[model samples]
Target: MARRVPRPAGAGAWGRSMGQGLLRKSKIGDNKSTQVDLWGGACMVRQVENVLLVLEYFAERRAPATVAEMTDHFGWPRSSAFNIVSTLAERGYLYEPRARGAYYPTPRWLTMAQAVSEADPVPAALTRVLDRLVDETGETAWIARASGLHVVMLDVRESPQMLRYVARPGMRLPIHVTGSGQALMARMATAEREALLKRIRYQAYNRNSPMEAETVRQQIADSEERGWFMSNSAFSSDLAGVALPIRIDGHAYAVTTAGPENRFVPRMPEIAAAIRGAVAAECGAGALDMTPLRAEA
Candidate 1:
């Protein structure tokens, strides 16, 4: 028989030690010894933030800026700043004339913004109507659109009085609480109104706020009977308001005027007439095609 070769001394122990070291290293990950360079550690996209910062800097300056000026202002390295400026110039957003020249934002940005602004129909139509309504009523006039179970004030023209009700654009109110909400419900079809009524959460905001469904339904019926809707201390104890429903391009909207209760309640009829006249003048008689509730009766 062949002689058995003797195994190397401590070879098994050495192999075990090497295996354990590898396992420990894998568990700890590469965070300890690896000095990751600037672009290698995090895989997040920071280019968007850099681009926005460049645009904002240009906007604040309102004049052309060279790459060196931008680097100094932003504390960025010269190479990084140059790359950002070059990329922006390559795109249509920035324009430069010479090889080493100042960069300016192109008219493309302004033209895009103007196009977006003009595309929105609400601002153009409601602005003209609210201006005249404010002049005629001398109270805060506003336009509100229905958003789910809430009414959002899209625009407002504040009253020129020392103690007038104040409302800001983008203020959201419960659909069951405000005069605009009631007018919107009144203008809806019967089936749709009933469906929406079920979704409303009836909470008593104040003593005057209608908390019961039956009471709210009665108020909606009353609003439908009249061409407009009114509320006195219903939303706030010291506030009163009147609202008229308007239809534009098959969308339902409400125009409202509100002020301190003592001043607004007495002039409800005048405010209602002013809103109607303003709508007629701005939108034309075709908008008045919605039959008045009394005519149906």
Candidate 2:
């Protein structure tokens, strides 16, 4: 079970009082500093945190958590914990399987998550492909789509290992530096790719990163020929990743596998093979069509 952070006395009241004021200020500023403020003053959203933490605790443990358990883990007052849990129960996000017993998250959360995933352009047909890749390779797998000058992770299936690379869904990476970025670039038309390259401000994120346009273009060509892109310590010294382009409905997407360098480097071929096999089995030859996105008029 994951341990929770401790809260000081009167923290709940302080959180409730400050939360309203902070919410008002956040709407006005709406800047980068607002994120810092929210994280730094997380105590102000203690009630919200309590609800999320309870849900996470249930997920990690695969069991229900009682009010007392939540109170002890978060160091929250018993009454505060009870109120938060009770509110969630009332909201249908959680349910008590037994009277005065532990609480568990309901299917409502999963349903909403599935709905959100379906709303993305990647299509639901690829979910099993990502899941199979993770199962076979024991590494994180993701589907990313190019968005302007950055590649955004549309969906992700995390590795089950205790120590693994985990990038959150919707996380963005530069188009000029990441393996997924290169894979996506490889599938685009020469003119479109060049246009995007010119717009990119290529700065090295690590010693291995290709900061020059010529070197990046060569890498993209290599990936185009090999049908996959691989990078070790390019974006982050401790991480390595492999990606392959998958085209769906004329949009380019990259399926990627990432993990700590020590584990990912040696298993590169195995990971690549797993991804190829998953894509072939799930999507078939029709899915390999790499038609470039038509330039918007």
Prediction RMSDs, each to the true structure: 22.8, 10.9
Candidate 1 lDDT, 190-245, residue by residue in tens: 77667877977666555678887788889877876776788877755677888988
Whole-structure CA lDDT of model 2 = 0.70
The lowest-lDDT stretch of 10 consecutive residues in candidate 1 is 19-28
Q: How much is 50 displaced in model 1, in angstroms?
A: 23
Question: Model 2: clashing residue pairs?
Answer: none
Model 2: residue 283 alpha-carbon error in angstroms: 0.8
Per-residue CA lDDT of model 2 for 1-297, tens digit only, reads 112242222111211122100111221112212111212122446666556656655654577778887776656799998888888889898898888698888999999988975685567778889989888998888999888887888888877776666555655677778888888887777898899888777665667888888999998887767767888777656788998888776667899999878888998878888888898899886676655556422
| Total clashing pairs for each candidate | 0, 0
Best by TM-score: 2
